[model samples]
Target: MYKSPLALMVSLSTLAQYAAAAGFIDDSQLTLSLRNNHFTTDNRESRGKIGNAAYTGQNKEWGQAFVLSYASGYTLGVVGFGIDALGQLGVRLDGGGKAGKAGVSRTPGQLFPLESDNSAVDDYAKLGLTGKARFAKSELRVGTLQPKLPVLLSNDGRLLPQTYEGYQLTSKDIKNLTLVGGLIEHAVGRSSTNDTGLAVNGGTRQSNKFTYAGGDWAVTPALTAQYYYGKLEDYYVQHFVGLTHVLPIANDQSLKTDLRYFRTSADGANDTAAGRAEGYAGAGYASTTGKIDSRVWSAAFTYTLGSHTLMVGQQQLSGGSGFYQVAQNSLPNEGAGPGSYYLLTDRQVSSFIRAGERTRFAQYSYDFAGLGVPGLSASMIYLKGDEIRTANGPDQHEWERDIALDYVVQGGPLKGVTFSVRQASLRSGAVSDLDQTRLLVNYKLRLL
Candidate 1:
């Protein structure tokens, strides 16, 4: 059952698609997509306050999103150019009652700054435009972007989704090598759909710019290396290095290995008194003068045989406080929750990289395409985090298990659409919370 006008709009969109296709509608580059998400969670840890709390009841939520896009290709010429526009809208279909509470602030809303008045907001919308140029193996884009990088990943867990306004340069000038560099000055939160300032967690509200540079190099047909650097104004500086190798074992069999490392420290205004005076805060063992340093390392390996793949990984963190980054002013990204960092030391459901923590993880995946179903797959992952030591002592441990199923329409009018469902269970003896479930559906259309 649907509760908001936006839900009705999504349904109507699907119907309109079928109707247009049936009526042989032509000459217009129009595309309609709908995504429905249902989330249910049980928080057994806290109900009242921060420290003192009881078990909270189960919560249920339902949300729907609609995206309508239009684009026209450039006319024939030596230099070709085109314009593209995107329209996004979201609505709360159910939940918002006592059973449904706010879990993540990434969801879109119009009436309320963060949460709606006792209930989820009825609807929200945003418009995006892009100017692009291409030549040979290199291309440049200026305007809004949703980049999935180590430092500035676009969070799409909620409705409208967060977007960055910036300029990016990408090139594949060399074989099997990709280079990227960008400067971003502003961000639009998931809810508001308006470009605003930036800030880090526990820091004073200020406009902080983000800049990053990175490259991936292929040494061989089976080996690759990656390196990147990122900085958030008055926050922390991060450097990342990674290597991946694929080893051939036999006919149609291979072993894949991944090695990653990160080094982080204080930077810019965070290193000065004026910046600290402006309300900047540091993570992990901040001294009287407020300085911190951190290191993280991780390695993972996967073995593939027929339709099954098995993976195992280990990660460790040491030195100053946990990893740090640009804090969220209004909402947090999917993996950037409290006590979490953008490092190899970040374990699912728990950050293994505290003052001193180690984590181990294993995962298994199956492709039904090998069984004749082309677009169905399943995966399960488990992670255990322990050996966390601080001024208090080493007496904390946590673990999480996740299962996921995914499928996409391979043929027919709904071809190219995708659907996914995920479930997660987490337990901890350390300072954390309880279990949660997330269901997501995604549909993409190419209008060019």
Candidate 2:
């Protein structure tokens, strides 16, 4: 049932009068975060294709970003109402794409929006508003959202974070259970202020409705199970299942096992060749026929002892396609916008997911707290993927290595300040061969 706009306004006005005086204003929060980020990439083998500038083979960008967030506590009473707001601004310091060779020009959308001449904009800003209602342990939110579910992993890898326009309902009334469902209509890119429709890998055509429902069940204190289903109108349908378990050994040691599986198939337009001819399919390398048919699975094991943690994992892709998520360069006129995959093998420079691929990965991490350095950490990871399917050639393989270091101020005036560095190298037979590095400094201040 749909209510008229006037009716909604009237109902909202009534609820405003009953706003829980104490809870609504007392628990509200406002914060502002400052981020300074620098990113550099070397195109390795794919370099020098555009030979106009001296630095044709490399891409570098430095930017500063500010994010302001506000959340109001729900009003008291049988039903509560609230509002949330987000504001973000990003300024480019250096490195927007300049003029390249005659016919081959580089696009300028790495960390900022592009101008009419394909140059990066000096700055860009975005604003979001959300209205929320609550009853018991369930809440409903409408408008801007950043959902971090298996089907929708909001991207925050760039100078800014991505946002989606949608309505979400989450309920936790049952014991040890969380139920989630939502409908998303549009999304704002990580570095874009424009809101655009949704699509998959290499698709140019957009879809307006993406719906999902899921639930997480905690069977035992150490075991949890998850199931989710998602459908992108006229694109594809996906089903996911996950299980996680933890085995406690001692006070300082434990083992964790994580397993995930997904099944995806073509829907509406993607089910027909004619529709795919009109740009209804995903990346061609992911599916030779441009149709969605995939089965993906992964298993990871982690061991924690003292300040040292080790993790090992493996992932496999079956059927005719590789694993894919929403909003992968799907916008018609946008460069590579931010999109994230919630896979164990999703690492810096490479996701390690391709058609008929098998990947094995490992990581070692150390916490400096044990060494009396309270808020410092370091980690290294390596991944190797093999047997990637090709259209008309033999199978290929690829590998990637990444190192990361982070430090955070534990106390004092600069308490919420952090510094991080990440470097990654990839040698891939499927994707681009590149080396990437990122440096970031972040500080957060409470405004209310």
> lDDT per residue, candidate 1, 1-448, as tens digits?
1344465455545544653554423433667777787776666673212354556566666778777765444433454444445567766676554433444332322221234344455565666665666566666777777777766677565555667777888889778889988877766666454565555655554554778889889999899999989887777788989899999998868899999888877777777777767666564444323444678888999999988999999988776565555545523322222212454434334455555567889999999999999999999988887766544544466777888899988999989778888887777655546676777888876542
Query: Compared with the true structure, what per-residue lDDT tens digits does model 2 show for residues 233-267?
Result: 87899999999999999999999999999898989
Runs off by more than 4 Å, candidate 2: 1-23, 46-56, 98-109, 286-288, 336-338
Q: Rate the local accuracy (lDDT) of all candidates.
A: 0.66, 0.83
Compute the lDDT of residue 182 as modeled in candidate 1. 84
For each candidate, what TM-score against the reference?
A: 0.80, 0.91
Error of 1 at 318 (Å): 1.5
